[model samples]
Target: MSGSEPAPVEDRRDSWEGPVPIPSGANETFWEATLEGELLYQRCEECGTSQLYPRAVCTGCGTTDPPFETSEGVGTVYSYTVCHVPGEPGFSDRTPYAVAAVALEEGPRLLALLDCDPEAVEVGMPLEVTFWQVSEEAAIPVFVPR
Candidate 1:
């Protein structure tokens, strides 16, 4: 190694495929549940509003804190897009895949990969949560036709 040489850039694509932002103060339970193949969300006890990207405070009423519960892992495609371009690394082999924002029956929308034939997907299509183990501590939730 020399001062004139640049350091090799590290690759982090194997960990996550997109902007994987986990909201502060509210992801421990959700990530823990994912390890067990379950999905979870927070529901405001003060006001019956459910939300994704879990938060410590309720987005509706600004409550000090909110309660959380496990979800059934069932949802419907609220919206989607067929990606001709590889949005993230490690996904070039899976080109032309569908990414969707699915609205869960319990009432929170989550963005995830849609695991089905691209031609078979449509808005409002039934879906169920599926897990993709990306690391020892994280497993992403993808969706598949139900």
Candidate 2:
């Protein structure tokens, strides 16, 4: 509801070969927004809880199929871990990347790749979301310093 959707800068890395998200029933809107340069989350109308990795019902209120809201795409680092080993194929050369738990300003926490030097991040660092279009139907949110 607060984050604006801006055209994403293309991700330069060509070695990435993880997985691409295929939009489905519950999370289709989230993936759709990514292509348009926006990030989406579900907010419950009844209990007012905001969450990521979209779900069919409110985790707080248990209401069915909560609506989606756009994120301001800004957050703070909550925690992180640096990976020196390739966790999946096509990532062997990308050793020492940081994966972080980012706490969004709007109230949800999400785990995303931190697009920065592993040594450059720390708890509470400010971040902003940018999408990397992994496929024509999907993009993944990667964060960098705001």
Candidate 3:
């Protein structure tokens, strides 16, 4: 697993009203790693494919238990949307935020909140991962300009 130093962190546990993730099944390790300011993805040792949204079974090969890899936490914006209207619960106060599908350098894409003014985002903009510790069980990945 290749990684840089632990990324920046912003503790949102006290103020977060959003839906906190409850780690279960294969994603437990993924969520656990977030607290340490690390981004994890699954890479199939058998087929050499990388994927996000950790799963018990590998997507490329039917290999059970693909190994985990730590990301460098750097990526570029693949696509994005500026939401003027709140899309999820607890986000009403955060209307007009940018959400992006970030294409990680490690070859997996992750959907995350882009932590900046919505107007500042651009396609292909370079980003680095950050974590918002929303709960004791998990933290959510957020991105910002690199």
TM-score of 2: 0.92
Q: Scored by Cα lDDT, where does model 3 land? A: 0.92
TM, every model = 0.82, 0.92, 0.96
Worst 10 residues of 1 by lDDT: 1-10
Q: Is candidate 1 or candidate 3 better by TM-score?
A: 3
Where is model 3 more than 4 Å wrong at Cα?
Answer: 1-3
**Candidate 3 lDDT, tens digit per residue, 19-138?**
899999999999999999999999999899999999999888789989999999999999999998888899999988999999999899989999998999999999999999999989
Error of 1 at 50 (Å): 0.3
By lDDT, highest first, what's the ranking? 3, 2, 1
Scored against the true structure, residue 57 in model 3 reaches a CA lDDT of: 90
The window of 10 residues in a row where model 3 has the poorest summed lDDT is 1-10
Error of 1 at 56 (Å): 1.7
Clashing pairs in 3: none
Q: Give the Cα error of residue 21 in candidate 3, in Å.
A: 0.6
lDDT of 2 by residue, 1-146 (tens): 23354747465336448867889999888888888888888889999999898999999989999999888889999999999997877667778899999999889999999989999999999999888887877889999987
Whole-model Cα lDDT of every candidate shown, in order: 0.75, 0.85, 0.92
